[model samples]
Target: MFFCLLSFYGGNGYAENDLQRDNPLEQYRQLFAEQQKEFEKQRRIIEEQGKEIEILKARINSLAAQSPSSQPPATEANNDQTVIAATSPKKKIEIPSKPVGQAPPQASEKPRPPEIPRLSETVGGVLTRKGNLVIEPALEYAYTDNNRVFLDAFTFLPAIAVGLIDLREIKRHSFIGSLAARYGITDRLEFEFRAPYVYRSDSQRSRAVSIGVGEDEIFNASGNDIGDLEFATRYQLNSGSGGWPIFVGNMVATVPTGTSPFEVDFVQSTPGAVFPTELPTGSGYFSFQPSITALYPSDPGVFFGNLSYSYNAETNENVGKVDPGDAVGLSFGMGFALNARSSFSLGYSHKHVFESEINGQTVNGSELDIGQLLIGYSFRFTPKTNINLSLGIGTTEDAQDIKLNLRLPMTFDFLSQAY
Candidate 1:
């Protein structure tokens, strides 16, 4: 009985062990099924995201079409073209009912190729950079009233007033002529000289004022050939592509070369419109004038306007120092590049004297106003030589009512030989 009982116990133990061994295998199968389901879910999500990306890309193209920089007027706009192509659903396809006398084809399922990401688009464009070097000759004239600053340097005004000169259409004629030469060292650097011809009392018909104490002052020489000459140099500090703004600077000196109408009668005359009451050339004095300017350009390669301010220093006379008389000027210009060999320009200039003082005294005498118009053109006959022609017409409150200037300049190239 005892042996039979032990055998029964051993058999029961074996059966329990077999059952436990199968538990691990069954758990493994269940876990595998769960993992497969997760993988399929992720794949579907990825496909849906791809379609969304395509939709976003199409939207971007639509927005680009509406922007201001869009293609030219004639080019057809394609706002929704991309979206339609991307989002349209495919039509159903039916299997061909086997063509007559053709072998039936076996259908094998295969994976489809993945969708590609939208990359950047193709564009065509151009950039332009060009420059020009020119040689020019220029002439200028200016006039003013009030003997205090003119005939007599004594009280900032000449006390005696004689007969005024010729007048036309409510304007007086104070005339001066100049001969100038200009050479462009580069697009940025320049060297120029201007020699002005004086209008002597006998050279032209004009009036003379006297200077002295209160009432009847002494007589003086006629105001002719009393103006001075100027020499200047300019440099372009900044210039980008033709479409951008530009900046330039200039330095100038005025030499005492003209006649002196004041010293003749030696009255109260000392200060005038850049003219000295003493002998011609006002003690051979020296002055410095600097100018800074800004420019803006327009299309059609022509319309560009510039404005500038010139700072002038007064003459150094041992008797007394004269305060600086400066000017504010504006220029409006238009030009056309006729061809590779020629160009044309039209412009207007207006200037005003801001303030002045004589011998440390603020005398409210007169303000000098000037207006002028310019028309000019340049031509190049050969690579070695060129000609520039220019003319100027006075508008009002100036030295002359009519004036014309012309220029012809040639260029020599040391760089050409190397190229």
Candidate 2:
């Protein structure tokens, strides 16, 4: 009986031991499963965070490509923080630190300089700015001396033609004072008007042969009167830079408001000797001149040129059918800016006039070629005033020997004050 009890107790002890081992094993399995679930959740969050970081990096690269130099530092930081918060839900993310001594992001490039008016502005006859007014009072003087030889007989038959030679010398002086007003209608357009008064004096000395007898005569004439009225407009076609050239188109019209030479009566002092009663102050024809001007600006200087054509309307007077010749003109020059307020220029001007028609026939000696060398100087008196002086030297016989001109230009801002 004793032996049987011992055996049963040992079996009970073995069962309790096995049950205790099973309970500990079950607890360990549950804890391991919980740990695996937590690991998986963390891995998924890390993957999402990685994907968000990649997206943020792409956006940052895109912004840098668009304007690398213009973006602010604060803007980039805010964007980075926003991405981190959306991706890292359970853990805090550390922002990357910038390198020491790193420079802040820069702004865009500097702006261009303002357009300022310079002495070269008027050298091409173009307006500088809108709402600007320029008043110019000017004076011009010219002197000319001419000699003519007249033969009464034909040149082919020298033996049949008697020695009839006449020599005439004429000296003339002219002075003009004018007031011109220019107003800018827009930045590229300008209007101009000019009125002039003229004074003239002429002296003629002639030696004539009549029937082989020579006689000398002298006459003098002087006149003072108003000259023609002129109106002009200038429009700038382009603004130039670097190697490009600025172009301007101009149209000028003249009115026959002064005394016409043809209207004056001729007094016969002696046979074959006729003198004008009064001197003429104008061409007595309505005319229009169309021109184009070009200016190319280089460093410290500018080059300019102009081409023009003038058309004069026909007129009827006491001298019968009169059609004045059309004329074409060309000028070229270079201007040097001596300083901020002064400039000098040298140029050449040429004009070719077509033959004039009288009574439907072309007149001999009516076509003229005129050329001149021009020198000009300009000085700014004040911010609103400038003085210009010019000299013209004749290069052709028909041109005046010398001419002097002075102009004073003053500016005012009428519209600005009104506004």
As a TM-score, model 1 comes out at 0.46
Q: Best candidate per lDDT, number?
A: 2
Q: How close is every model to the real structure, measured as TM-score?
A: 0.46, 0.69
Deviation of model 2 at 403, angstroms: 1.0
**TM-score of predicted structure 2:** 0.69
In order, how many clashes per candidate?
13, 0
lDDT score at residue 217, model 2, on the 0-100 scale: 72
Best TM-score among the predictions, by candidate number: 2
What tens digits encode model 1's per-residue C-alpha lDDT throughout 1-419? 88899999998999878876867987788789999999999999889868876765654455444534443243222334434444444532221222324455679532111111100000000000012233333333433332222332334336544532221112223444555555555545666676665542211112233322233223323355545677777666664354555555667777766653223433233222122233342324456656554444444344444455656666545446666567777766666667777776777777786666678776564467777776766677687455655565667744345555444444444445447
Tens-digit lDDT track of model 2 for 1-419:
88899999998999988887878987788789999999999999889878878987775555454443554476666767766776766765544444324478799632211111222223343373578899989899999999987666556665465545667798999999999999988877889899999999988877766444356678888778899999988887765655567778889999998888887767755455566767888888999999887777775877888889999999998778899999999988888888898888888888899999988999888899999888888888898988888888999998999988888889998888888
Task: Give Cα-based local distance difference scores for all models.
Answer: 0.49, 0.77
